[model samples]
Target chain A: MKNLHVNFCGVAFKNPLVLASGVLGVTAPSLSRVIELGAGGITTKSLWREPHPGHPNPTMFGTKEYFMNAVGLSDAGLVKGVQTMKELRERTKEPIIANIVAGNIQDFGAIAEAIAELSPDAIEVNISCPNVESEFGKPFACSRIDAAAVTKLVRANVGDIPIAIKLSPNVESIVDIAKAVVDAGADAITAINTVGPGMRWNIDLRTPILSNRVGGVSGPAIFPIAVKAVYDIHAALPNTPIIATGGVNSGRDALEIMMAGGTLVGVGTAIYYHGDATWKKFTDEMSQWLEKSEFETLSDIIGIFHKA
Target chain B: MGCCGGGCGKQNGEETLHHELNTEPRAFVIDRMWEEAENIRTFVFKGTLHAKPGQFCMLWIPECDEKPFSIARDYDGEIWLTICKVGPATTRLFEMKAGDYVGIRGAYGQGFSTALTPSPSPKGRGEHSKVVLIGGGYGTAPLHFTGKCHQDAGSDVTMIIGARHKNLLIWEKESKDSGFRTLVATNDGSAGIQGFTTHILEDLLKNEAIDLVQTCGPEKMMRAIVEMCIDQGVPCEVSVERYMKCGFGICGQCVVETGEKMCQTGPVVSAEKAMTFSDFGVFHRGAEGQRKNW
Candidate 1:
């Protein structure tokens, strides 16, 4: 098989398929399990300064087309988050990206400083989480200034550690926010958090499905949106690295986003559909797709669409 | 690509059968309700979940927290949930009367293997494998279902259900009504035996040539059962409980020391695998995935 390896934000990933934050990503065992099952790297669930009591279940649900969740960004807080990161570093050789989320710019810097101790391969600043608007009040990704403020704070605190600012699709201009974060000292970008705090309810119950009433829409339904977001971002900031997430369920989806200029692909909802086999299937499919072309590795095709 | 197993489109075959996560929770009206004890109530709903004996469904009390409950019985198309009025979800669930609707989905996770794993038992017939089931309190509900399935499979089955008192024991009548030999044990001596469910296991093992043992209850009791089954060289499967989110493998909240997600690799595990779980009887994660000693 052709090498599927790629370097994202200065960290070497065995392959482009990285486990997205929020899905099977809290503990060392969970993150390690995903890696053992074939993920090239792991992005932990958003780490917080203190334990967050996310909305209650049914926080998540999935269909063939989409996976919806309003887990409300529940996490075990920073102390436990760093400990798990340390455990993961000891357990696996796979690259680990510490995904941190905060309601304020100051807390963003605090978490960034704490994660620096474990020295994760990358720090994914999750300013785009869609479900926690009630607690955090409209994601920082909603405004270019707010997004950049969080990015600048995180960037200033983490020494030389690579910081990938995770952007949201529920924004007026994803590219503008992407560019602002990059300009604000971000080393990379994780494009597109869940698409919407969308609502789906059964008429029979007279209630919305999620306890939070609405949640971020993911799964294969958002695959095209992710591609477009990445395409638009890569078109403007061709030099900036992007960790493309949202609706990437197959190898073709991964390739489409890469060609649109994603440095690494984030996969989460697929675990609901394919379990651990999701990663191996993606890389294997990508290798077969690459074998039919001139590219020797996945990186050869990064932003290949822009070149044409 | 095909039936949307994440477009796992496994092998690019439309006919490929893969597991699809049931992400949608639909409403089902309670067809009936029976108060089994002061605290324990059994609600019957209309649905063809086709759940296996040990599998469970997430019970959603619209707008309240959703939780996993064992499918106590599925008769024709009616599924039953035996709930103990305890926390927020169950408390709200208890307030509902018949015809009330609640969101239900699942038949998720591995169930007790009625056919038994490893086809050839010492008797060489995995089918019709003689089995013993032990359940404590609400745990009795699922074991009763497992025992009923064994009976349906033409297997010799025995169900031993126990609680603090006769009032707390859930399925003695149901298990016995299903034609399986049923025994009851209670700590207060208000039921069959005047001791714990663990107290009866030794004598039962001495008498019965059992092929498999299945349990769900207090972790300490389940652990003891697993140890006894191991000593007897009988295969065993135990259903474990842990506070969870995502009610699936993607969250590690319900993961045991074996790194197995109870929502995925288990909720039901073999005796050998259960023994390997260091945190099995010691602790389970709280809602925040923080360790809470049991």
Candidate 2:
């Protein structure tokens, strides 16, 4: 059988399938459950130094095609969130990608420093979440300077831990932002943290569907957009490790993402559609395809689209 | 529909079912809309979303918010939502007419337990398998479907509906129309019993042989019913409401104290499990994941 194991940014994963942040990674038990379900690793829901009470009800909405959410990064504050991650670390040896976000650059560093103390396998700096733009203004990833600033500060604060700066697909130049952060000391990058702070309308109600009015769109409909973003980023920075998250629903989709330069495929919205076993389904299908193609590892296909 | 005895096939077992995952909201035409009670209305829509009794759907009102509503009735090819105008989303839903269009996704979440069905014979054990459904305020909506499911399954079903007053008491006539033996209670003594539904529940427990009790309503009322069911040794199931984002379970906002997400493990939970929750009656989390008094 072809080996599915992948080494991403110095951390080992049995497979390239990692649970994307914000799906079911809210609590320790939930994250652990995802690990048990066959995910190679899991990212914690974006945590903050202080508890943020996201928006009111109707924070999420979806159709058969896509899902929109503005959960506002509501989390259990730094102390509790870190404690949960530490507990998660104690229970399993799987890589934990601690996702952190902040209202400003300084707080970003502070939160990264605090979470780094727990010694996660990696620290994913969330500078591009579109849902929180209402509260914190346009995402840092939208501006190369701000994105690089946050990346630089987080890289400095986290010390030796690998840092992946997550980028937004809503920006004009994702590659510019990606390059800026990479140059600023980011060890890795997670491309496309949802696309468009889009809105859905309730025609009968004459109002917006999300309580937050608008939210970041994710799921199968945005898969093409995510693929392009990852492809572009990989072309720009061929050596940088990339975690492609968005609209990955099936094994074929994951394979496509890997071929587009994703070292690790992030599975989020598929769980909403296919149920929690989606990760296993993805990896299983990917393995079958690899064996059928006589490929021994994911590296054989990573960025295959770019070959002459 | 019999209960799975805590081992619902979907829970703690091999993942065997593949539900179609649709994120695009389907356009459902409102075939009919009528006021059920003082502030309650039932919207009958022509749609094709198959839903279990306790399962819910996210109703998307274009440009407005999407909210979860229990499948009150799914008769003929029509789905019904018995809504009370309690908030912005529902208020907008209430304003819509019969010809309006609305977006719908899912018939999501685990429905009520079917464990106590296939009715116990009256001669063999009359009181041992009777199903009692207690609904307070708008919480009575989903129970109508639960009662019908039990009745259709050949079990004796009784519905107790309570409201602040006679005007707010919902589904009493509908229950009666559907051939269910329904009891009504009003806080102002404007109807059958002049007190809370729990008071009527107490009298029923004293007089009848209720095998199981299922309830939904204000958390305080459900808590009382759960406590009563525990004291009487009757198995109970409850449908709870929370600030839900994704009706399928991703949002994590609809979690009860046991860390079980209401969207996944339940919008319906058993009395035994309900009692284990420290936040059951006292509080619930809001969109911010902070505790708010229920």
Candidate 3:
């Protein structure tokens, strides 16, 4: 039997396919549906200390290849979200990764500590969300000091559980940001979130189509950029587990990210557009191609395309 | 199509058939695409789409925004949308080829009345009624077939269209012979009247006895026309536009602030009801009734 199991941040998944957060994890019932459809694991929607109603209207827009969403991190708060996770644990056999975000370093640590008690498979500390006007905006990660401060706070408080820092690609150099997180004691990293706040104007109406005016851009358009970011981060921290995200639409996309040195793949907007079957598509199709290509395992593909 | 019943391909726990049942939302596919005017293209799609005019559909092109567009024509397992290449979604839509799968969902919002079901006449022909259809720019597409449907029902059809320039006037040749009277308006005096379509409509309402008035365009223009109809006591309907995410009622993304659900109830609403919109004629609404100036 071909072994499909892969280890992510020291935890085992039936395969490398995991449902990246956002709307995919908004409610427990939806999360259960994702697991039933065959995802190796699932990540909860990013949670914060307080409930945020999110931005003004028009937070999400869809295009042909992919979609752009700026739900403004509308989460149920750490306590409520942790409770949902506990309920999820009862029904799903798949590993659950909790995603946490905070306005400041203290909240990040506090939420990390709270989720740690629930015993999730791992924790993803999201330090970058470009679509909203939040405290962790450009100034926080534009310099090394802020990134280090937040990462250190989470590391100090989040007891022995594996901690991954989800980095932003909007900065001057992603390498500098990745280094800051690694220096702060992050065990792994999920590179890139949705890119730039974009806009759409209706010519007939002669006005901007989206109510938010701008939102985070994702899909095939950001695939190349995300891949490059993952490649660079993996090269910079060869030992750090990197979970690749952004514009991963299919199993072929998953394969490319792994070849670019991603240990696991994070799927978000694609799941919103295509639903849970996308996760199964990524795993089943990639497994078939991997076996047909005579590759023994996933690690063989990691960074294989980035040989210097 | 029958509902999935949330129970498909499951018999005795042995996988008997392998036809993949869609576990997610169905996307729109453009089977044929062509430019009908400068910056305007007609996308002919063949899919299992069930949509009606005034009911919006979300068109997704990978790497661009998923946009909400009105269904212009629906027939025989095919759908058509006459769109202006505005924003990233339409711009990318212009680059699509035949057979490219475009994500689609909808038949959302309230649609137009099916021509009053026609009262039976003693002569076996429906009694003639007077219907005036007004459209501005691409908003004209939905009204085209609607006017045709009216004409088919033995109603007198008059179509008044407005665009910024003369070149933007499309389908004039086709609509000219569809048993309807055509009136053209442009921002510049190059084509017909050198003013907004509402200016011409105001004159029409004052002189001619119109039984039904249907309008769709910019919110301000629609509001003006609706108000005029309200004052004159003409039965009026307007097709509205809003930023929609899921074309179905799920995502609450494309809602107008009538304090009513736009996706579930309408993109097409009575002029009397539209006047109650808090954001009416002032701004556009997003998924959650957030305003963007009209």
Candidate 4:
């Protein structure tokens, strides 16, 4: 009886694996392509009311352990985001979550309101990108007050659309921030953006690798932090849906996070590590694990460890 | 075997599954630089890549832009890239000196498979593979390396190079010197044969038995060659280019209309697959991943 489908905040996903924001999230066709490859939902890359140039070339680099991107939130802006959402929404019945980012609290409201007109499955407010420190110093997720204020503002503008506040792992108390956003009217929480605005120096050249010098760390390196964050968030707000995204590269990793209290597991950097089959591979591995464990359904394991 | 050994798991051991590797552009000293033709220059870095023919490197110039360049040659623990001063990045590269430093990452892309058998009949492995490589301008750069591979593997290699004029044709001398058969064509009839690479390919197909055809150049020219090969039932592979932010497959910026993430599924695609891309031979995505006519 076990199946991968899950209903998160009234939106039914074929599986819990959502295409994480900011990865293959730009174009409608590209987003549709991810869904085609087996992602249960689409989370468009963080968009702003206006187009962002992001950073220059050498924006990203990777290794076996981690993937670093200082892509500085390069997006074609909200107009394109809406246009792409419309196109992608028409193609598939799978849920689309419009992920939006901004420099100020009010702009978050404005962007969220604009995206609400399209009536996406949900709206993910991004208050935590580690790479844009120079432009917007210290993400709002660092403080519970700012996180709540941004959440309240977005909740006010987004009409009845479900709101998931994306938080950064760099914070000292993810649970406090999660509770604050929930109290401020967020219906769900996407735990952990990229960890550590980390950097690397090409020692042979004796210089920095990324054009922005430092970028957010992602991939398998940050999976543990993601699990811990999701664990705490779900423990604090057991009723609120949680989208756990950091580095769930395999089926076991997906189940591990859900066991740690994640409702929807997000897969991003794994695409780089595992190729286009990242979604298929994650689902296959997850289904196999579930079958072996004799779980009646995938939802039966959500926050299972927290029960004990 | 520092990084080239089978342990890396990149196209290693049994399955020849080539993949995109996570890479940072590490600086390499330009050992030498030379002028090839009008607006074309070759830079040789004191660097080596775990790469094969038809693979590329993301060439970076400090304050300039980062662009992918086909590895013209990988020899003597050094990497060579050919560039034409067509854009901002290449112009910056053209301005650099021999002693200067540049950055390169990869040896990425699913490259050409030298193991070729003509389609339809599926020739026996007993006979040496005969490959016809067509290059337009600097597109011939990688095919130069490819011709060497086919020749070294005991296969017969013929390189048909095309350009707007004689001065634009590249890799002719290198191909001939490497002992592969060389053919040339130009729009103005200033080289070996006139008209286009397709004209040369037509004659070659009419006259000889080609086990495979690999081409890279202008999209339209390659399209013609691809169509011809598909029609004749000759196996073919073509190297394609598009606006790519990352050489790795994650970006999805380089996914052509056929849903082919060119960096992963190909920069080298079989002729049959190319036809299915619908977007192939038509338009390519610009920097913003927007479609623009070829």
Candidate 5:
């Protein structure tokens, strides 16, 4: 097939397709398996400074077109997170993106500093998780000041290692938030953590589906929103790298995000629809489409919509 | 992929067909509900998900959280789900009666073989193949379906079921009625043999010329059976249970220590592959994927 390699925020990836955080990225073994399956890079599940139990059972629910989850960013804490990264580095050379989440701004820096000790490929500041609003109040990404504060703190602690500020689409103006994080020293931006703390209910029992009653909605339903988020952010800051994550299920969706200015396509929920080999299947589809279109490389299409 | 004997291919094709049909939860009318054992009820529903022996379905009780249940029976298009009253969702499910409406999707995960043409008997006991099925607790639910399938395929199936006591044992009469050689064990010796199912399995492995050993039960018991099968040089498949959120592998809650997500790769895995999981008998992750003592 065609070469699907790409470089994002100074890190080389075999393909633009990356295993998004929170699918099968909970452990080192699962992360390594995703790398073996064909993911160009893998992001660990959002790590906390201490172990967070997250929400109770019925934390997640899925329909054919959409999946909603309120896992509450539960992780084994920074100690296990560092050990997992160390073990992962020993096993595979695949790029590792350490995703850090915290209740307060200072904890974000503390966790980032702890993870930086292990020297991951990049650090992703998860300031936009919508599902934990019950425990943490509003997401940091909801306000530009809060978003920039979290990014600036993490950026100061991580040294020179690139930091990607994961942004939320639920904000009033995603472009403004993206600009704030970029101005605050974010090396890259991952748009759209999940759309809405949406809900599903059982009419018969008159009760909510998820134990949390509401969760971040993902899967095919959020693709257009993600593309628009990437497009808007890219339009505002052409120099800032973007990792577009939302509802990318197929290669066409990945190409759409790239065309809209995404440097990498983050896939998580699609693993349910396509199985573990989703990355390979998506890349193969993209290669065949590229070959037929006679595009020499991914850069030829990345941000093509901007020119149009 | 490990021990289903050509069932995986058909399952893949059926999955594609189901995907094309609709991803929405289909309405299943509960036709019957039998209180099989203490805090356990078996509900048979008229639905249209073509599930294999070891595969599972996401039983949706509307507003009460969808949980993954092993396909206990799939007679024609009627599906059976045996549930234990464990949590809020299942407690709500237990309160559900016949003619009630519930939603079901998938018949997901890898299952035990339905097409297992067991090796011919070594003692020349006709063309019937000898297959041993050991079940413990609620784990016996899925094994009943597997035993029936094997029996229908002209396999001499022996079902050894164990529970904490006689009142806890499920599907014993059903297996006996189906012409399966039924054996029972209880922890308090209120039934057939005193001790765990593994002890009976050890005796069976020694005396009986068994072809395949299939088991589903408490992780410790299953792990013990896996070790015994390995020592006896017998190929075995065990059904493993884990906390599953999204039944199609999106949620990582059901992943074992071997990095295999049980929701997709298996609920039914080979004893060899199960042995590879460091947490096989030791621990399982909870809803948030935190390691919990099994």
Candidate 6:
């Protein structure tokens, strides 16, 4: 019956729960359903310039700890996604964050220009896509320069709409990338994308589990990696608002992410593994745990590991 | 007849059960039971779940990897899972007592919708519209629910179920007693009609002016029946299964690309749309887009 509100990068969340990008914010109706089920906010599936054909088939694989996907930032682009945003905004009282990914520096500005018209509460820049490989191809958010370039490009044009730079877990030094985005005027940080060009093979078929041959590994398997990124980024920049992503499934996972320095936990694979009710379950369960632990507010738990 | 009869049908208690989404597994207890057949039984659970009928829930017991089973029936505060002791989870499930605690989460995947907007039934199941429900293996569960729904809505129902042998046909008596004109088939001719359920379905489709046909089971058989329905112009819905790791859309593990993620979009897809699926009844994809040959 009690309300659990928290602030993520200055935006207030009724709860510290958000539907992570790529975690089933595929359409307006589904996103609306998630909000009705009590998520704090909904992040649209990361959108791109054109409708990405993505891989042929078998785009994802899984393990007990986690799963992997190389969906190639598969999307219906911003123009089509705007309809979903319009509907979500019209129906749900929750904040809507538009996720944008581009293949080139200029593309970031173009997408920012397009999404600014949609009038979402925030924008998340995904620079961690492996699909951005060629010189002409989109670049991953692993490097400070590449990440910064995209950030500055979007920030230069997209005014007022808060921007959260999503970081890559594959990088050797995440701190550099985090700092680079911060310098580029990012409003917040969504730590860690799916890790690696992960692979799996079925012995019976003598073939790989995914059609792309590699994918970003996610699920329960990547929780530790996600937690570490949040912790490291928080330690490096104490004031930076972080949205922890990857393998978070339950209220405990959300609490751990917040404790590790993330202000809000993103539900990606968990929504796929679980369902919308899980979001409500996470908030109720985590809030109860937090209240019982004598934590005064969600802010009180942020980065507790560092103090210990 | 009401929506869920025999105390085995209910939607879910997601709206009422205020469970926090914690890592700790939630507990469930068996509230009632429906003996479908000798070994196949429908276990009605009074636990918290936000489930869709065609979607599945993972049953986890310590030291045992969780296994997925579809929701056979649903109503407020409860759901019925028709299960067979085919594997580890089911075997362990069979060992559970009425008062025993079980771990459960999710009612994952998109479910079939019968156009709740009060459209005319394709096979007007108002006690006069003839309908045929076909199921094989564990596929009988959802089809049974479909049959019950039709019967509740006043449609005359005929159900055909098949298995390897007479002993394998679960839920036979219930199908017969439920006022559904029941037909049974087995590969070994141990009982009921000899040969595949599809053959029986084909004969019925040929002979009767059946209004609607819904089916589940092995992909090949479902496809064959679906193809038959398509040829006959009888509307049909199929409950599909995927080797899922996460029932949600993110892990992308259980995607059956029918132009959308199956987990998020559907577990029950129309025969019309399912025909467009590249892997429909033939293959499923792995993480790399490789055809995971079924």
Best DockQ among the predictions, by candidate number: 1
Instruction: List CA RMSD, all candidates.
Output: 4.5, 5.4, 14.3, 3.3, 3.9, 12.7
Model 5: per-residue lDDT, tens digit, B99-128? 788777776778886566545554556666
What would the DockQ be for model 1? 0.55
Q: Which should have the higher DockQ, number 1 or number 4?
A: 1
lDDT of 2 by residue, B116-194 (tens): 5445543367543578888999889988877776765567888999988888888898789877788998888999888
- Candidate 5, residue B139: the lDDT equals 92
Q: After superposing candidate 4, which stretches have Cα over 4 Å from the reference?
A: A292-295, B1-22, B117-128
In Å, residue A144's CA in model 3 sits off its true spot by 1.7
Comparing to the true complex, what docking class would candidate 2 get?
A: acceptable
Candidate 1 vs candidate 2, lDDT winner = 1
lDDT for B192 (candidate 5): 85
TM-score of each predicted structure versus truth? 0.94, 0.79, 0.56, 0.91, 0.89, 0.60
Best by TM-score: 1
Q: For residues B93-169, what per-residue lDDT tens digits would candidate 6 score against the true structure?
A: 78777866566556665554432334465555443666678889778887666666677656778989999887778
Interface RMSD of 1: 1.9
Residues A72-175 of candidate 3: C-alpha lDDT, one tens digit per residue = 77665765676678878987878888898887777877888888888888888877777665434563555678888888888888788888888777888988
**Per-prediction interface RMSD in Å:** 1.9, 4.1, 11.0, 2.3, 3.6, 11.6
lDDT of 4: 0.83
Give the docking tier of candidate 3.
incorrect
Query: Candidate 1 on B136-219: residue-level lDDT in tens?
Result: 888887777677666665678888888998778787777778788888899989989899888887888897678888999999
Interface RMSD against the true structure, candidate 2:
4.1
What ranking emerges by DockQ with the best candidate at the front?
1, 4, 5, 2, 6, 3
